[model samples]
Target: MTLRRAWVAVAIAAVLAFPWAAGSYVNYVTCLALTYSLVTLSLNWVTGYAGQITLGQGGFFAVGAYLTAAAVVHAGWPLPAAILLSAVATGALGLLLGVPALRLQGHYLALATLFFSLAVPEAIMALPSLTGGANGINVPPSTTFFGLHLSNLRDAYYVLIALVTLVVLVDRTMLRSKLGRAFLAIRDSETAAASVGIPIEVYKVTAFTASGVIAGLAGGLYGSIAGYLNPATFDLWLSIYFFAALIVGGLGNVYGAVIGGILVVALPQLFSQAQNLANILYGAILVVVLLTLPGGVADWPRLSRAVRWLWHPR
Candidate 1:
């Protein structure tokens, strides 16, 4: 086999065996990272490939979480069923939101999405009966199906691994498809894409819908793993962090989304004991990465080549 394929196989094997040796906390964080990766990847779908800026990811995240939680707690739906329903609902919401987005550009679109982020929490507050308001809502992770219980973090981790693998494949496939070309075209030059008969409006809406569906799925996974939902959890900073992580990990690529998604969550935890030190270190790291790689962590390939060139001088 080729070197790249062999490396990939080894990486997959290591990931599969990770939880076996890792502590509970480590496994839990990895699971959270996987969930956040979904959010970042979905954000990449709309903002990265489609060139549509969004500040409402947290809002859509809340929608997915709440819908899943409500279905499980109020409507007596199974966890899997609730997640499926939530995805569909969020996709519809994306389509509705996209209509207005068709008229917006740059900061105007950003503001509209920002408004959404601001509005979601308040709407939850208004519905204290269902949402539990500030207290949020909880659903124990003791979900059962076919006599098998999924109460362990390891179970969740494995499931996340599977989901991440599937999503990654889908991302790669879509990036090679006509739809992907259309989005990239629109991103580079909308007028040119339109001149070539590409439906800008339809594609824009499709991007939103696809992003929403993926974000909804992420929220569903998060809700299940977290066993709780709070408006405070889906705050404006959460939306902001999606962008931050995307930039840090790299943009317009799936691997970057995963790297950024995982790091954005994992980094704070790694330095949880020292807030000030963590802040300083994070700033330093960001500066170093920006100056050196510029393409974020996923740009290590270029970094490696530069290192090699320095040693060889040929």
Candidate 2:
């Protein structure tokens, strides 16, 4: 436990110093990665830990971004307030969706979510006067925190790091509690969990609500950092990417979410000149992981130990 704490401390310190270690563009990318990490973490909770297949994450993400953008641009709300309200609004929506969704399982649930993901952009395009329609909406820069103005990307990076740290801490704490155990039990076997009096439906909905809140928060941060929002940005492909990250990083692992988030954000930049090839490479990597590392990259340490033990049967 002490070693685990020390590793976390080191990771935190590295993140805190990242901007200084890299260029402005890198810092900006890091901020984006952190935002996606939050989204990945949200997905991990609902799909990974709770065994719910939701392809509608992109819908919730779009809702959060648009709501935040509208509130800040039109309602004249502060960024923090806009974010808070967006989270609540999205959480409510998640609960509404979950009530009907929890009845379905496997591919049925996945298709329902896929439809939700597809519907968001259509809804946005239909509501032009409010959502800015197909042209998209512009988000203002994050101006002040507690009356102190943040002037640049570096300042925003610091704020993002702090937010990510807080989120990770909260996630860690929650996963160590009975609630997390319940989520796992439900994921492993709904019948068994219910037989044990785990209140499966209640916990499932709670997981959805929690997932939506985190996704909403991520969307708010993405809007603030990107300073723009359009329907195209949160499309079905984005939802696929979220799931892909979860798979690559290892489902049901918080650290896996972080790794997946970084890869999702960074991979495109690495292959910006060959976008098609990048897509191919991404798909190939997923196939490889699925075939070789069924538990994803997070299980590498265990895999390594097994390999070493086999080679040197001590």
Candidate 3:
């Protein structure tokens, strides 16, 4: 078979075998990995591909989670409708927020987005009646589809995997399309891209909207996973973590997004099990990776070629 066909077969087998081979605990980790992967992909569209530096992605994710939880737990909406509505509302807010804020770049943009992210949970804290205030709110039981309920972690795992796969596939396709080229153009030189007739504002706004929509979707799934929502869960620190994950994984590469997602979620859990030692180790590894492998793990192909050349004798 051709390389492409071989890869397709490998992917199919992996998907088919994953759930059955993994135990409940492993499945739970997988669930978190998938959820975060979705968020990373969305963030990548702007941060990695479009060269936008945003730290408020966590705010959008939190909005989606909180909105979904409120709609289902309190307002009694079905999960599907709630998810869609949350995405739309969050996308609208992202567009609204991105418009004025996109005018700033570098430190100014970062600070603005950082402030937005920091404010999100605090705003929830201040709204006791609607958001349950500081103590947070419990998520409702998982949704049912065609008489099958998805309340357990195992079931939620499958849902997340499905969503992550869908989003990744769609994003990979889009990144190879004309719009993706537009995004890169805007990234490299917006002025030159506009000079050649690209719609700079439109692409920038679209990237923000897309990022918000995916973040919201991921947040909705994550709320269900956590089984509760707290103001602290979506704080500015979480945004920092997300950015760190992206940088460590690789920029402008979908595979890097997946690796980064797993590292961000699972590595922390592994650290938690080791008390303070895990943090020291994690920090050490991060420093080493940043210094030695600045291009990220996803750049292994390029690194391999370089190593081969370096060892080759003239």
Error of 2 at 41 (Å): 0.3
Computed on alpha carbons, the lDDT of every model, listed in order, comes to 0.83, 0.84, 0.79
- lDDT-based ranking: 2, 1, 3
Clash count, one per candidate: 0, 0, 0
TM-score-best of 1 and 3:
1
Q: How close is candidate 3 to the true structure, as a TM-score?
A: 0.89
| 158-241 per-residue lDDT for model 1 (tens digits) | 887888878878987898999989999999999999999999999999999988998898888788788888888888878987
Please identify which of the two predictions, 1 or 3, would achieve the higher lDDT against the true structure: 1
Error of 3 at 292 (Å): 3.2
Backbone clash pairs for candidate 2 read none
Per-residue lDDT over 236-279 for candidate 3, one digit per residue giving the tens place of the 0 to 100 score: 86787677778778777777787787877887788676746755
TM-score of 2: 0.90
Q: What does candidate 1 score on TM? A: 0.90
In model 2, the runs with Cα more than 4 Å from the true position are 1-12, 145-151, 302-314
Kindly report which residue pairs in candidate 3 clash with one another.
none
Please give the RMSD to the true structure for each candidate, in Å: 4.3, 4.5, 4.8
Candidate 3 regions with alpha-carbon error over 4 angstroms: 2-11, 145-148, 274-286, 302-314
